[model samples]
Target: MCIQTELQRFQTEFNQTLVQTFSQLPNDIAPKLHQAMEYSVSNGGKRLRPFLLQIMAKVLAIDPKLIQPAAVALECIHSYSLVHDDLPAMDDDDLRRGKPTCHIQFDEAHAILAGDALQTLAFELLINADVQTDIKLSWVKILAQASGYQGMCGGQSLDLEAENKSVGLESLANIHSLKTGALLKAAVSMGCAAQRNLSDEQKQKFERFAELIGLAFQIQDDILDVTATTDALGKPQGSDQKSNKSTYPSLLGLTGAVHKAEQVFQSALEQIEDLPYNTQPLMDFAQFIIKRQH
Candidate 1:
């Protein structure tokens, strides 16, 4: 099947599972909070992290069904991060996935609570999944570290701190590696953890692949912030510059940033070349990442 066709199918199935998961929430929960959570999670965006997890699971010869819960859990974490990132206290954005941000559609307090709820719900889903104890433990540990201070939050802190300050390439790279790259790395690692036959070296290769793509992904995002329209990006164009945040394009010239993205993408492809599986899908996805307009 074509990669686009496969992606569409995966997206449809994943969205159904996500809606069903939301529908199962206890009736006693606050109606507004539930709505906000659903609104944020269900809003349309490329399900990149979950899709990467699913693809990695396939590469590892694990059943997609067996890894579905983990995929969903990873997405919840990603979505929660976005929700909080768009809050007034953070990026202070008003749009997400072409719709009002959670805080804008609801209110600041509700958005905060919704983000908090989604964060905890991610762990709950993982713990409740019908997987082995060790697998669950591994997923929890990987996700917690990625979502907490050691990873995304830490990166976000660095990002906020770098605003309006002149930062070099190394400092910028370090900030993104923690903030954006951590959860992406966790996705691939979790998929590897699900497979019992893989060696530690093989797992490391997959992680390296993820790290390279994560860098490429952020670079592309920086590029799009400068070049794409607000409609195309589904958020304010040039928000990074407006916020005075240093970006790949800011440090590296636009042409240099584009070159860097392609360079990183090529490095990512090398990581998967020796893996014993049909890697066409992964390669195609990585290509799409650097080439994506949004």
Candidate 2:
């Protein structure tokens, strides 16, 4: 099958599974707070992390059902980051997925609280999920590390510091590797961790694959910030430039950014080319990151 077709199939199932699980959260926990959590969590994302987890599962010929906790964990962490990132203290974005941001749609305080709750609930899902204790512990540890100091938060701290400074390509890559790539890397590793019996070498192979694609994903996001329109993006475009944020395109130029993304994509694909299966979904996903207008 073609890449888009595979992606579409996964996206459809992932969305359905995520929504169904999200809806199962208790309604008694302050309905408004639930609303905020639901609003942010249910807000549209490409569902990239969980999708990556499923793809990794496919490599093992494992049932995708086994990875629900990991998938939900990915979505929760992703949504929590967005909630905090859009706050006045952060990006101050007004729109997301074609709607007002969490702070705008809900109050700023609720947004903050919701983000906090989501972060905590991510661990809760991992612990309380109906999985083997060994697997749950491993997944929990990976998510905690990825969403904490070594991952998204760490990256954001660097991004905040680089605001007025001229960040070089290496620094930019480092920041993105942590800020964005960490969770993506975690998603892949967590999927492998969930496997009943994956070889250490197989796990490493997937982890390496994750690292490559994860970095490529962020580069594509940076390129889209400059190349895509707000309508297509479903959020304000050019905000990166407006904020004077250092980006690949700004530092390397647009043509150079595209070339850099291509290089990263190829590097990612190279890690797994010796495996005994087609890599069309991964290839398409890499291309989708750069080729997408939004």
Candidate 3:
């Protein structure tokens, strides 16, 4: 199938499935809190992480019924990060996916609480997923390590500290690897974990691939911030610039940033060469990352 067709199908089915997942939650879990949960999770975005996980599951030719829990758990973790990332203490943005940010719409405290709840919910879903104990334990450990102080949170802290300050490529790579790359890596890891088909070396290769794509994805976002429109992006263009954050475009010129992104993209693509022919969706997604305007 064409990349567009694949992506559109993924988006439609993922969103629908996510909404159903949200609806299944109990109302007694705090109505306002639940509303905040719905608001954050159901907001418009690419839903890239879950989409990638689901596609990876498909690449393994696994049944959807067997994969929904993993996919949904991935989305929950992703959504939780965004909720925290948009808080007053973090990105502090007023807009998200072209709508009011979680904090803006629901107040900062609720947003923080919502984020905390979502983080916990991710683990809960993973542990309760209709999968084997070993698989659940492995996935939970991987995700926790990725989202903890050593991963996304650590990256975010570094980013906050590094703003407006110059840093070398090694330091910058560390930041991106943690901030953005970690989750993307987790997405791919969860997919492999879902299948338990990847060997240790293959697992390492997937990690390397995800790291490259994750950085490229962020670089593409940096490019889009300068080149795309708010309508096209569904969020404020130049928001990063406005926030005075360091980016590839800021460090290396736009041309240089594109070069950097391309390098990562190519290296990531190369990792799939040795694996079996289960990489079409992954390649398409990588292509989508480089070419996407938003």
Candidate 4:
């Protein structure tokens, strides 16, 4: 199948599976909190992280059913991070996916609880998956490190600290490596973990690919913040500039930032070239990240 067709099919399958999985959440939970959680998860973005996990599983010939739990779990964790990130104490944004942020649609306290619930729910889904003990344990550790203080959260802290300051390129890269790249790396690693046959070296190569793509993804985001319209992006355009946060375009000029993005994009393709499987989808995904409007 063509890359576009494959992505469309994967997105449909992902949405159906995600809705079904969330439907299994017990009805006994508080109605308002439940509604907030459902609203946040169901209201969508690109679902890129989970899509990467599913695609990697497909490439490895792992059972799609086994991949579902991790795919959903990663998305849950991703959504939870966004929810907290948009809270008044964080990014303080009022919009996401062209809709009111969780804290805006619901109250701040409920949004906080919803994010907390989703965070814990991710672990529950992973633990309950029909996988071996050691692999499951490994996945749990990977996720914790990626989404916790060492990864996304830590990156956000660094980002907050860097605000209104002229940060060097290396300092900015370090911040994004943890903030944006950590979970993305975990997505690829989790997919590899599901397959018991991959060697350590193979896993490392895939991770390197993911890391470069993650950086590329962030660079494109910064470019779009300058170049794309709000309607196209679904979020406010130029919010990064509005927030005075350091971005690629802020440090490197527009042309230079685009060049940097292309460089990282090429490096990602090279990283995965030696893998045994056809990598058209992964390459296409890297292209999509660079070209995406939002």
Of 2 and 3, the candidate ahead on TM-score is 3
For residues 103-163, write the lDDT of model 2, one tens digit per residue. Answer: 8998999999999999998999889988889999999999999989988999999998999
Residue pairs that clash (backbone atoms under 3 angstroms), model 3: none
**Backbone clash count for every predicted candidate, in the order shown:** 0, 0, 0, 0
**Poorest 10 consecutive residues by lDDT, candidate 1:** 1-10
Candidate 4 error regions (>4 Å): none
* C-alpha lDDT values of all predictions: 0.90, 0.84, 0.83, 0.89
RMSD of 4: 1.1
Whose TM-score is higher: candidate 3's or candidate 4's? 4
Error of 2 at 292 (Å): 2.5
Model 2 vs. true fold: TM: 0.94
* Order of candidate numbers by TM-score, starting with the best: 1, 4, 3, 2
Question: For residues 1-294, could you state the per-residue lDDT of candidate 3 as single tens digits?
Answer: 887787778788888887787788886869889889878888876778877777777776767677677777777778888889887777777888889988899888889888888888888888888888888988899899898899998998998898778777678889988988888888888778877667888878877888889989988988899989998887778887888877888889899999999988999999987787478788888888788877
* Most TM-score-accurate candidate: 1
lDDT, model 4: 0.89
Output the number of the lDDT-best candidate: 1
Compute the lDDT for candidate 3: 0.83
Give candidate 2's total backbone clashes.
Answer: 0
- Model 2 residue 276 lDDT score: 61
